[model samples]
Target: MLPPELPPLPALTRAEGELIDRYLEVLDLLGRINPARNSGTYTGLRAAQALVTKAAALRDALTVMHNRGESELHGETLARALRVLDGERRAGLVTVPPPADN
Candidate 1:
């Protein structure tokens, strides 16, 4: 069966798009590094190492936006964009999971 069509991405400025993309990348790395979620130290360590680079990229994205005079954040619009990009699920992975039942 054909999968349902995904919603179109919300309109965003170039910097905003970069910011979202970089932010998601960082979230993915964080999720992998999350001790509660990760099973192995080596895996988490690798993610932690990669996180430094991803975080720098995220910072650069924001810096570009700031330099471009995009001072105020459009929270509602960006929230929509994040939702479209599955930010909630990605971000959730960074959190500690619930305790297992006995």
Candidate 2:
């Protein structure tokens, strides 16, 4: 059987697109660095190190938006965009997992 169709992504300004992309990048790095999720210090350390750069890029995306006079965040629209981008799953990786059943 054919897979279910996915919803289309919301229309976004160039800066907003960059913002979402950068934010997801940071989220991914954080997930990798999450101690509860990771077993190796070296892997977490690498993700932690990369977190600094990804965070900076996220900052830059926001700064660009501000400079361009996009002051307000459209939460509803962005939330849709994030959902379309699998953000829920990506974000879940950063959170502490539920207790394991014995």
Candidate 3:
């Protein structure tokens, strides 16, 4: 069954909304790779897993910071994480672009 739709959130600024979108993009890219099942060549998969895990950790950290009213720090932290992913993308490791317009 489909979940019920709710009203839009009031707390999320456009910047935060974009970051959330980026988070989904990152997850989608990682989900396409079967990290656990790929046994033939584990090294690249493991690195990708590590990259996604670290990105997720940064997202989680931003959530905590936002909840604590210290959301000012989220932009820089998320940018750093996105920058790392952008480097990987430029190296042809992933497809999602970093938060370019932000």
Q: Pick the candidate with the highest lDDT.
A: 2
Instruction: For candidate 3, give the lDDT of residue 9.
Output: 42
Reference-based TM-score of each model: 0.96, 0.95, 0.32
List candidate 1 segments past 4 Å from native: none
lDDT of 1 by residue, 1-102 (tens): 998887889899999999999999999999998999899999999999999999999999999999988998899889899998999999999999999999
Which candidate model has the greater TM-score, 1 or 3?
Answer: 1
RMSD, candidate 1, Å: 0.8
Which pairs clash (backbone N, Cα, C closer than 3 Å) in model 3?
none
Q: Which candidate tops TM-score?
A: 1
Tally clashing residue pairs in candidate 2. 0
Query: Which is superior by lDDT, 2 or 3?
Result: 2
Ranking by lDDT: 2, 1, 3
Whole-model lDDT values for every prediction: 0.93, 0.95, 0.53
Sequence-dependent TM-score of model 3: 0.32
Cα misplacement distance, residue 89 of candidate 2 (Å): 0.9
Which candidate do you rate higher for lDDT, 1 or 2?
2
* Superposed model 2: Cα runs more than 4 Å off: none
After superposition, the stretches of candidate 3 with alpha carbons farther than 4 Å from their true spots are 1-3, 37-102
Candidate 2 has its poorest 10 consecutive residues by lDDT at 3-12
